[model samples]
Target: MSQIASTDWYRAGAHGIDIRVRLTPKGGRDALDGIVALADGTSVLAARVRSAPEKGAANAALEKLVAGALGVARATVAVASGHKARLKTVHVDGDARELSGALTALAESIGTRPN
Candidate 1:
């Protein structure tokens, strides 16, 4: 994985970390697109899910995808904010450093950069 400076998409918290995600529902397949910077200069982890954004299906899929990417249990991941919006804040319970490293690796594996 390519090395980069500390990312803004996630922040280490007392319990674990809070990740900023920009989601694309019904995106054909479930995958992490990469890191992206918004117009306001806030970075987010771009993700897509096959599920439609109805009755929280897309939110559930995003939680699962994040848990899998961070090598944590599904129960440990939750959508902390933006229940009905494209951008969301997800909270994961685990070691912050380890999760951050895993996220970095996952991002590199997808070969994506901020756009």
Candidate 2:
């Protein structure tokens, strides 16, 4: 992983950023809680959405939540993998450095407390 808290879960890519997120479905509201370190030594960003994990609704909600928080267009964010799993890889199309910095700040404020 990248070591930089944000880069640990996300990386700069050709299109923009590849983000690893642990999502909480049907959570009361959409929010980014913080980060979490798994027992296997993997770090993932914690986030929650109100939508249930059915028919891709939760995935859609998660993308929207991330896009809104990052000030990017909703169409720019998409779940790249792990559609049926809690851990998902999302691709955000835009400025990787800018997004990485913003996410780093957010991780610092929230810390790795899990959801």
Candidate 3:
């Protein structure tokens, strides 16, 4: 099993992950925005969304898009803040480094890299 599987982070009801996400919200032709990468052990994945924040639709879409991409259930994701802003929080369940690396790859594909 992956380290994420061994840690309590995935234990449900305990040890949540933080990702720094960046939303793109119509970067051009892309239907949805890309998820920006944050450091590990953070709940700010910096996920970018192509949908505008209209009546909480963007936020919901973001949750689905991000959770799908991360291979986690939507229950694992939530907007800790920035409901009307571009940046938001993404809670995950997994190992810090593993999750971070996955997000970094996703971000890189969209021409963004984590620091």
Candidate 4:
């Protein structure tokens, strides 16, 4: 679970943190499974969406999901990149430390205790 908070996935951006997420569209439900490590040592939040990867529904769901997880306004979250790919970068605008704390809590909820 240490990989979830790894610097390799999220970075402090000009306005906020840019988090890498690997979304599974058409998943049975809208949920966050935890962190997943790529073959190349990259880590991403493993998220699932009930919406299909069409007409941007899945992207919207992902934004909402991430916003909820971060305890921020839905409008503050955006799909920064990878709109057409499973792997996406989500841009969240808010207090960086507060957001990080929220993410830490989320990680704990999923049984990934931060060190």
Candidate 5:
């Protein structure tokens, strides 16, 4: 629904993320990739999914991917928005700072450098 050039997400706690996401399905993988955009017009971790968007396959894949990236249990990540749309919301259940560092590290790994 909206366009964000980029964003830097930091996990402060289980609910560190106070942002929005515009998910993009990169079908053809078991992993999830999409843009997590914030109000400041920042985004990062453009996730890519190997699974096709069907029967929650994409959703599951997204959860796994994000959880793995965040180093938290898949159960920790919950879809907070966009069930039937390309966009979705995932909430973390932990410390805000941890999530932030994790996100920053992930961004660095992918050379995305979210800011």
Candidate 6:
């Protein structure tokens, strides 16, 4: 795992953390691709889901994927914002530092650390 900063994708809050994700619907698989920088220089976690972007299917899949990645219960993860957009903010209910560490490890395992 390279030395990538977790601040690029997640931020610790009072209860847990908020994660910024750029989701790709109908991506043929559910997976986290790593971190990426948008044109505005804001970084986001790149994720893909096999479900189509219809009637919140993609959003549900994203929540499941994130919960699984962070080793949390599905009920603990929710799409806090961006219900109809490609980019979304997810809120996880847990220890902020623990969740952040899990996300950092997951990103490193995916080998998509930002340069």
Candidate with top lDDT is 6
Candidate 2's displacement at residue 86, Å, is: 0.9
* TM-score (all chains, Cα) for each model: 0.90, 0.89, 0.56, 0.88, 0.69, 0.91
- Writing each residue's lDDT as its tens digit, candidate 3 over 67-112 gives 7776777986786667777766556765656665666565555442
Ranking by lDDT: 6, 1, 2, 4, 5, 3
Per residue, candidate 4 scores C-alpha lDDT tens digits across 6-53 of 455677756888889899999999998876677777777889999999
Candidate 3 TM-score, true structure as reference: 0.56
TM-score of 2: 0.89
- Local accuracy of candidate 5 as per-residue lDDT tens digits, 1-115: 4433334433244455633445556556654344445446556445667767778877777788788877888888876778777656677777777677776666555553232
Choose 1 or 3, whichever is better by lDDT.
1
Q: Which ranges in model 4 have alpha carbons more than 4 Å from their true place?
A: 1-5, 112-115
Residue pairs with backbone atoms closer than 3 Å in model 1 (clashes) = none
TM-score, model 5 to reference = 0.69
Per-residue lDDT of 37 in model 2: 76
**Per-residue error (Å), model 6, residue 81:** 0.6
Give candidate 6 regions above 4 Å deviation: 1-4, 113-115
Q: Give the residue spans of candidate 1 off by over 4 A.
A: 1-6
lDDT of each: 0.87, 0.85, 0.54, 0.82, 0.61, 0.88
- Candidate 6 — worst ten consecutive residues by lDDT sum? 1-10
In model 1, state the lDDT of residue 29: 96
**Residue 87 local lDDT, model 6:** 86
* Runs of candidate 2 exceeding 4 Å displacement: 1-4
Estimate candidate 6's alpha-carbon lDDT, on a 0 to 1 scale. Answer: 0.88
Between prediction 4 and prediction 6, the one with superior lDDT is 6
lDDT (Cα, tens digit) per residue for candidate 1, span 1-115:
3333447788988789899999999999999887777788787888999999999999999999988888899999999999999999999998888888887787678654756
Tell me model 1's lDDT, rounded to 2 decimals: 0.87
Predicted structure 2: clash tally = 0
Which prediction has the highest TM-score against the true structure? 6
